[model samples]
Target: MNLNKAWGILKENGFKETTKRNQILEIFEGDERYLTARDILDVMQKDYPSMSYDTVYRNLATFVSLDILEATELSGEKHFRMHCESDHHHHHFICMDCGKIKEIPLCPMDLLGAALPAYEIDNHKFEIYGKCPECK
Candidate 1:
C-alpha cells in the first residue's frame, strides 16, 4: 500500500504526522494480515524500544478516523485492517476457535447492486463464523 497517499489523507483530515503516527503507519504498511491494537503494540515495542502501548492505540484511532485504516470487531475484540478500497472490497470469515480471519471475495453484491439504488444504500460488511480447516 502507498504510505504517502495514506499520510496525505491523514493530513487532509487535520492530523499531524507525528513520530508515533509514522511508526504506526510503518507497521500497517508491513502487515499482510489483519492486526489488532495489541498485535501492533507487541510488534512496535520490538522495533521501537521507547514506544508506548498507549501511543500505538491512540494513533490507531486517529488512523481509523482519517479513513486510512478500518476496525473490525469479532467476539468483542477489535482488529485493524488496511482500508485500501482500490485493492478490493470484500468481507471476512473468522474462525472463532483459532482466532483466524479469512478474506472472502464479495459475490452477492453483484446481484444485490442491480436491485438497489446507489443513494439508498450506503456501505456494507459481512462476517461469517465457523471453524477454519485447521481448527475443524
Candidate 2:
C-alpha cells in the first residue's frame, strides 16, 4: 500500500526516502543541532499537513533505537542529534551556538592517573562546548 516504507534510501545517511522521514532528515541536514521533539514537530508542520506529534515521536524513537540519532539532555530538556562514532576512543566538541560536532582525537583518561582512588567508576562522558568556526 506504500504506507510507511514508501521511500527508497539513496545512500547511507541514516534515512529512508519516505516523505515524512526525508522531511525530518532535511531538518537535521539544514541545521545540525540538538532538536527537541517540539522542535522537530514545529518544523515538519510547515511541510506536512497531516503530521502528528505522536508520529514524530515514533520516528524519533526508531532513529534512537537504530543508533542513527543520539538523545541527550540540556539544561532540563531532552534533545536529539545525529550520531557519529569512530572505531577508536575519542570525544567530540559541540558548538553551543550551532550543534555542529567536531571530533577530538584524544582521550582525557589517558592523561589521568587511575580512577581517583576507589570511586567505582563505571563510565564517563566527555564533550567540549563552544562556538564553531563558522559561528565565531
Candidate 3:
C-alpha cells in the first residue's frame, strides 16, 4: 500500500502518526523483499541511534495486526514485508536467500479441496520458498 493509504488506516484505527512509524513504513514502501527486525533496526539506528529492538518489534507487530504488513517465518526467524496491493486471489514464491518475493497467480486449494472432500476449509495461505533466479 502507498504511504497515504497506510497513514489513513492508522488514523482510522486511532493510531497517532510518528516519525519512527513513518520511517518504518518508508523502509517497506519501495521494497518487494521481506526484512527481519535486525535488518530494520540497522537502518533505523542510523537515524535513531538510541532505538531499541523492543520498539522496532512493537511496531512490526502493530503493522502486522493492522494488515499493513505481512509476516512469514524463514530459517526460524520472522520476516516482514508490506501487504500486497493486488485485489485478486494469489499466493507467492519467496526467495530463501535474498528475501525477494514473486507473485503466483494460482491457488493450490482448487486441487487440495478436491482431495479433502470431507473437511471444510475456511482460510489458507500458500507460499513456495526457494532461491529466486538472480539469487540462484
Q: Would you estimate the TM-scores of all the predictions?
A: 0.68, 0.68, 0.90
lDDT of 3 by residue, 1-136 (tens): 8889999999999999999999999999978899999999999999999989998999999999998998988778999999999988888999988889999998988777678777888878798989999999
What is the number of residue pairs that collide in model 1?
0
Full candidate order by TM-score, most accurate first: 3, 1, 2
- Residues 9-125, model 2: lDDT tens digits: 233445545678777766765566788999999988888877899988988887777666677766687788766546577778878887777889998887765858776767778
> How far does residue 19 in candidate 3 sit from its true spot (Å)?
0.4
Rank candidates by lDDT, best first: 3, 1, 2
| Model 3: lowest-lDDT 10 consecutive positions | 109-118
Worst 10 residues of 2 by lDDT: 1-10
Model 1 per-residue lDDT tens digits across residues 16-109: 8777678778877776456878888888788778778788778888788877887888667788877756567677787777656677877567
Q: Which residue segments of model 2 deviate by more than 4 Å?
A: 1-18, 110-122
Clashes of 2: 1
